[model samples]
Target chain A: MSQRPYNFAAGPAVLPEDVLRQVAAEMLDWHGSGMSVMEMSHRGKEFISIADTAQRDLRELLRVPDNFRTLFMQGGGLGENAFVPLNLSRGGKVDVVLTGSWSRKSAGEARRYADVHVAADAADSGRIPEHWDLRPDAAYVHVCTNETIDGLEFHELPVVPNDVPLVIDCSSHVLSRPIDWSRVGLAFAGAQKNLGPAGLTLVFVRDDLLGHALDICPAAFNYETVAKADSMFNTPPTFAIYVAGLVFQWLKRFEYQGLKGLAAIEQRNIDKAKLLYGAIDASSLYVNRVHPSCRSRMNVPFFLKDERLNDGFLAEAKAAGLLQLKGHKSVGGMRASIYNAMSMEGVQALVAFLKDFEARHG
Target chain B: MSQRPYNFAAGPAVLPEDVLRQVAAEMLDWHGSGMSVMEMSHRGKEFISIADTAQRDLRELLRVPDNFRTLFMQGGGLGENAFVPLNLSRGGKVDVVLTGSWSRKSAGEARRYADVHVAADAADSGRIPEHWDLRPDAAYVHVCTNETIDGLEFHELPVVPNDVPLVIDCSSHVLSRPIDWSRVGLAFAGAQKNLGPAGLTLVFVRDDLLGHALDICPAAFNYETVAKADSMFNTPPTFAIYVAGLVFQWLKRFEYQGLKGLAAIEQRNIDKAKLLYGAIDASSLYVNRVHPSCRSRMNVPFFLKDERLNDGFLAEAKAAGLLQLKGHKSVGGMRASIYNAMSMEGVQALVAFLKDFEARHG
Candidate 1:
């Protein structure tokens, strides 16, 4: 019913409308502080409260252990591609499972800091590879739990032996469902997708993983330094953090199908994914190369059987009030990113549009 | 005249009211794009246009030369302290002029990547050191043109010998006035003080300085890699960049007392600084330790002769519609950061408050 069209752009994708409205309402003044959240010093009590609440809420939402420190960092996932290795690699061997584009990039970046060995690679398969050659002596095993571009996700984390910490780049799917923190030693996500904005990065690092930073690590990006300062080691992306805090609050209050909070959102996400995947499976005109077991619930990349209809498909979708449905240039097909912000109505509308478009051209 | 109090928080400082209003108004829909600026993908046309316009407008405002690649990066000035060294240091000798706390930090950070030699030390003196011991073959000569904490500023850049590049950390004073780019190889600012929001950092690096990143440098922070990708090597802090773009537009349209754009803003800044510094000099109750010639036009750190009155002064100032008058804890006194967003009227109000406070407490 809202005039705003459904936006399906991948990362830096749609935020909840309610969160956007609240951010707008508070732009000029936040909580009677007489300063926009953007204007407040990071060290101030008001902004500190905002940062603290966001951290606490995120911990609760993810069921993150008290042993982990949640860092509100800048420099997106690409920045963390280096930060993770620099902080956790200890210039030692780093094992990476290359499930998709994000994990591949993470591996490539880690090579600069450590001797990166690919534990498993499934870039062509569009699935989380079953076998992993993770080394026990490796400092950390890296994985992209959810690949935004490849539309592949891990249903569960891979087991790493000998307590080699598992580092996951969950940029595209953090907060949509509960994180299995017990399996993750470190998790970093650029906050543009399911979180808040593009400029802020969220890093959750276990206490035991701290203080192993290579001497070359930038102090600002070092887990030990950042943990000591409570992510205020430097001036944080204050506005983005505040906006993310709002998103966290929105998620905490979310309800669906008699379920509450994270469970409710997870259920809704499952439903949305099921509906879209079902539509794709039922359609002779459409094809999804990704394996069903590993297809991302957040991003559904689909192709028309007749590749010639790609442009027409996108054009019609846009006209039908569905936007940014264009697939990434690297992968030529349509990707509908049903992030937590995407409504069921939006998904239903997309499904309806896909069927209508196929009927007209099939 | 506005209900908003005058905010003087140093970096992540106040933004222009008009820009904030426009940002708030466009939060849900941006230029009929059906997506909030925050929701749009960084690579999408709408967001690209926003990024381009911001880069272009910033170039125009600062009169940046074509030879310079302006990077819209993340990580605050603290991050840049390492990034600059990583990108430009070449694991060689880095000469740093220790002006104050910021340059000292810069020097300390640079030491992690290169052999940092203190060319000059004026940390104790609230003035730019007159003499420098320049290394002819040093990688780069570093300086903090405006020290946000110690309140010292270089009115003119120190002359580096043998064409050694002069790198400036002009975080607090960038865009407040023109830069003498002819003498500088690189200039970096965290876009919180005179720009928009806290997360976005602006770097202007000469084309020649692009390719020499140390192998240990994170590709995301590497100037050459970022420049080659047009600062899109990764997903940038899109929302922060968008807001900063709005601030750029605001600055471009700004007019003051027969001056226009940056010149007008510069004139206004000079007037504001002169008014506040004049008040401090004339009052026996107030003191600004920094020398007159080298004092910052943006962040004016002042002290009360009776140090015990500091708490009372800040409390009273906050009650009187003035906020964040407290200085940095490192050099505790009082800092009145009159960034470009600070109006002449706001400065006038602060001056009046200063007079009234002095009248009551002197």
Candidate 2:
């Protein structure tokens, strides 16, 4: 067997090896259904069961509130930038916490249908803003719980007026920790990061948030329509959903340090983040610019103190079987996205490499 | 090995077994990259190469001209309904040829963004209408080349004004035949049907049609935006693209009935359609409502002369390893969607079962 390289892609990111192997085993025929999950019609009974099981497993893994209806959607985080405003804004005022690039793009896209008001901006700091001007009558407040590019994460969700739904894009850090459903009215995450694949976006919308979409909202994307149809309104990314279901099941069985599932995964994520950040802080050759108070647990962005080592570091990392560590183009530094699928051993290997490289370069 | 059942699902339909096997084989590690294709970043070299090769192969298979930019999009055919007008209509009059269920939905959805003029309606005949009320000032003319539910197909594309771009929703029959690039402006198909899976959409838009998206268009779905970004405006459904690239490779090497590649697939489709249609035509127990002149080659909706036998027919078909032969709820009859992946032998099996069932029940 070939050695499995540790993948650090932001997303479509690494999936659990066990989940991938299980998916491969069931690829030709899903549970003796005589059809691959990909081949079954969205409306067919076989696919319906697969979807139902997936939705159920996902709900269990996330401990999604009973009031929150999980809709399997498309268009990713970027598409949802436009989709969120179109569906929830109702051509009204939308308050945005411009934490980083993701929220900034969300606010920019929201301007198409609504009057976008940046309640606070943290572009320079690459952290969640300390201040926010809340508009109670505003349609919703958009936030990025974890900024994939800026490597900033909100340790705690911001408090907004009860009237305004908190639409959080947790694309990068979803599933790494349990979301506080009590504070969030709608939380959407593209599955690529922590869930499953690129094509499927998971929207956990509070039941009350449905049906407020403006007339222009595409019916297929309308939260009300999608929730009512159970996300089968249009063919709901069947294969992605199937793979995600496997990941969810794998998550349910996940255990580490005597903890289980979400708790277990969250603990592991914390450890991985600490170990990597500890290395960076201990090193004279590397630095992470984000405020440690809101540093992302899933995405660790670090730079060589000597900028000239960037290419050499990347090349050597690739040679050492660490892949996709190149940071987003918006940020020139390196970013290692250690999602749930990324095991602790992988991060340890990366840390070892980082130390070895620093020893030689420093 | 368990018998490979014949799946006739409308979309999210059957895939080539060989492609499925190849995908399964590479499920754990893609070409020793030590990561599944689903885990690779869309912008990464590995996934980018996969997307590019898929685009190139599809272009070659369809004989798509140089001027057309092949975009991998999301939101499916329904999403494209809104995406189309939002991008191409510019809030102007958009002419539509309403052939059946699919086109009706298209025209209705377009009315939100444009003054949709139903240039042609074939609801009564279940075939292409003769006269078209094409307006020269219209942004583009919309048509569903194959109406999946209505079992109607346009034998010939209408000769609209040179100023009007002909946008086709060829979701169900895209790769089944050669497209006349001279007559098309933009063609979009959700990959669920003839291609690999759901959640991925193939958009072939001419270069001249770029940059006219309305302010309301989501940058992710905007033709100009997506075209410029090589469909990486969002993650662009990485897994779906990899599977589709495999399908394209399968199509490139396909040989049967003294033909090769697209020619071979088209010939097989022609033969399959004829065999099934002939069986229905000659049968006393079954009836195909579609007009013979424009019956769909990909989806054939047939009814039992005795409607009471519908349940029995579906049950027997399922028992005989013919799955998902049930018609769409909108059309209360059996629909046999013999897509590109449906072999000639599969159609023959269906025909054989049809005759045997008729002898038993009729």
Largest DockQ belongs to which candidate?
1
Residues A162-200, model 1: lDDT tens digits: 988989899999998888888989999999999898899
Candidate 1, residue B38: how far the Cα is off, in Å: 0.2
Writing each residue's lDDT as its tens digit, candidate 2 over A260-321 gives: 99999999999999999999999999899999999999989888888888999999999999
Per lDDT, the best of the predicted structures is 1
Over B1-362, each residue of candidate 2 has an lDDT whose tens digit, in order, gives 33788888888899999999999999988897878998888887788789889988999999999999999999999999999998889899999988898999999899888998888788677668888888989999999999999889877776677668999999999999999989989999999999998999999999999999988888888899888888888788989999999999999999997789999999998889999999999999999988899999999999998999999899999999999988889879899999999988899899999999999999
lDDT for each residue of candidate 1 in B40-118, tens digit (9 for 90 to 100):
9888889899999999999999999999999989998999999999999899999998888899899999989999999
Score chain A of each prediction against the true chain A by TM-score and list the results.
0.98, 0.98
Give each prediction's DockQ, rounded to 2 decimals.
0.90, 0.87
For model 2, the stretches where C-alpha displacement exceeds 4 angstroms are none
Q: How accurate locally is residue B99 in candidate 1, as Cα lDDT from 0 to 100?
A: 82
